[model samples]
Target: MSAPEPVVVVGAGPVGLSAALAAHALGLRPLLLEARTRTAERPGSRAVFVHRATLDRLDAVRPGLGTEIAARGLVWDTRRTLWAGRQVHLRTYPADPATAPFTSLPQTVVEDLLRRACDEAGVRTLWGDPVREAVPSSEGVRLRTASGAVHGARHVIAADGARSAVREAVGIGLDGSTSATEFVVVDVADGERPARPERVFHYRHPAAGGRHVLLVPFQGGWRVDVQCRPGDDARHLAATAREWLPAVLPQVPGPEVTWSSVYRFQLRVAARFADATGRVLLTGEAAHLLPPFGARGMNSGVGDAVAAARAVRDDAVEAYARERRTAAERNVRAAGAALDHLLAPRPGLRLLQRSAAVAAPLWPRAGRWLDAAPYGPRIRKVRY
Candidate 1:
């Protein structure tokens, strides 16, 4: 009797963990490899929003995994949009009885839950073993780790993020454009008083020198994104958040920043999601990179992980490559549109935004447009 095929998953982020669990459920032996140790510090409240579709994918891997995550995150019922210190739109919906539409929690917490799921499934994980080289043949993939150890995998699922060693080793390249706007993202601890659990987006904040700012509530804190104009110093802005943040967010009293960083986001997709031998498949940020405007990055990556596992189990790499790349393209386009709307780079777009703001008081539809435009035609448009 032959042994069960071995599917090796690279990286130990949410995506890799999801892939490992999915593979195990699909009756395949899975091995997970992480460059970082178990105690590595994962900084920042990255990828706070987890969509319902993402939860559905995780549930398919394990019966109660999605429920565990949903229960642990925040589900804000209010969404507000403002223009130049004036509220343009405000909408609140009643919470669902059975399940929330989505959940907001730190990516670190999600990863912790995913890691726990992997452990429960008895998935083998090797820490501190980064893959330095990956050579694929018609039969399988040969992976050499930083520890000078070689691993032969029946199939390799690459979820090592944008700077993926496995993707590079397989000779896949990402192609897309980057935003001109420098964005400063910060996570702040929950403050005292008046700061309601809601999501707010301000176009041209009056208090912050007319820059754009978005405040989203999560489990224990808020993830804030401030868009910087040309020549603005992101580092300087992040350093002095306490000063300007208070003025912009009067609802929060003396909010303390937990994490802050500058980012010039990219919209990219891999040329191919699989190698020529069909022995290596890319998932998560390894296959695509989208701006965080629509919360498309991590959510879409989860979908990729589940699909990749199914492909490996069914021996249908080419089909996986085609379908996932198509999904990546749609997500890139949607995120790009959202970014463009937020930046308003051209005179026409700026004029349109100003016109919409002026008309918002008289026309509710205009306000709704302003509120929804930043999220890019809803997730159904992408159909991922």
Candidate 2:
């Protein structure tokens, strides 16, 4: 295969965009393909947290993106845990001047910034032409778009989301299971929250009926997540938030709902992150799936993009697969452990949560580890 051959990037979401941008930085041509005519401008917020390491990855691939994105989003360090209407653990992320802080922004804003970066790089992106199928052979892989136009590439990066067509075409299988917890995500415009700017997670909220409610502030509003039973009505977010959030945060004057959704979180890992010949790779949700907790899904996906591109440039796709799978398994374990603490019917687990909340103030480090990744810090590169 020739180095000049374009690496076809399927999916134009953050993962795909990062992959394309990273490929360009690695001196490889990236031809991006998006099923949608335009980028997502959804009213709802999904995968909104951009961790410190992720900001560094973005800036490395595209100069000044990290600073620009941080400038446009809201950064918060302190996260408090509450139970029965009282503050328990006030966990704080200490200032690390060497690295970028964690940031929160709407999904639309993230996409818009990425789109601008793509334009700046002069990367080729084909919109309205979804990748329908990928035919791999000895020479290269041939991609058939939804419009039936065939494009040939030496390699393909599949960031087409969890339900990836390229993954199905290449015959990859996921190994994990979907969680039973159904989460109702509510995005409210200009919702009422504390003036200090922080994150609040409540367990057994009174109005929420023993379930958890995560309150996160965005650029101009707050995103409230209410844990509901599988059989609960998903459409009643307004009523549920009014009942639970008001009891928890008295400062909320009125929450105007912008968007809402109820989804069953899943803990899934692809059997492989790359093909046998190492010509195709999966990034972001295409490679793994985890609950939205800890903000690992999209952030980790961005990591996948950078790693995959570097692997392609280095001619070591297998290493990329191993390192990414390791990261996915790590994140999955953390998210699962946290979920277990949140929903484990055992009273002992409840006591643990409550204890951590109460003890966090005196022993701040106790609360710090409660809401952290089970493995370690975000894995940036694979060291052989």
Model 2 quality (TM-score): 0.88
* Cα RMSD for candidates in order: 1.9, 3.6
RMSD of 2: 3.6
Predicted candidate 1 versus true structure: per-residue lDDT over 141-198, tens digit per residue: 8888998988888899999999999999989999998887899998889875536788
TM-score of every prediction relative to native: 0.97, 0.88
Q: Where does candidate 2 clash, by residue pair?
A: 88-357
List ranges where model 2 is wrong by over 4 Å. Answer: 1-4, 39-41, 92-100, 191-194, 237-249, 354-384
In model 1, what lDDT does residue 16 have?
95
lDDT of 2 by residue, 262-366 (tens): 787789989999987688899989999988765688889999999988988898888999988998888887667666766755789667666776777688775
Which 10 consecutive residues of model 2 have the lowest summed lDDT? 375-384
Q: How much lDDT does each candidate structure score?
A: 0.88, 0.78
**Model number with the top lDDT:** 1
Segments of candidate 1 deviating more than 4 angstroms? 1-5, 192-194, 379-381
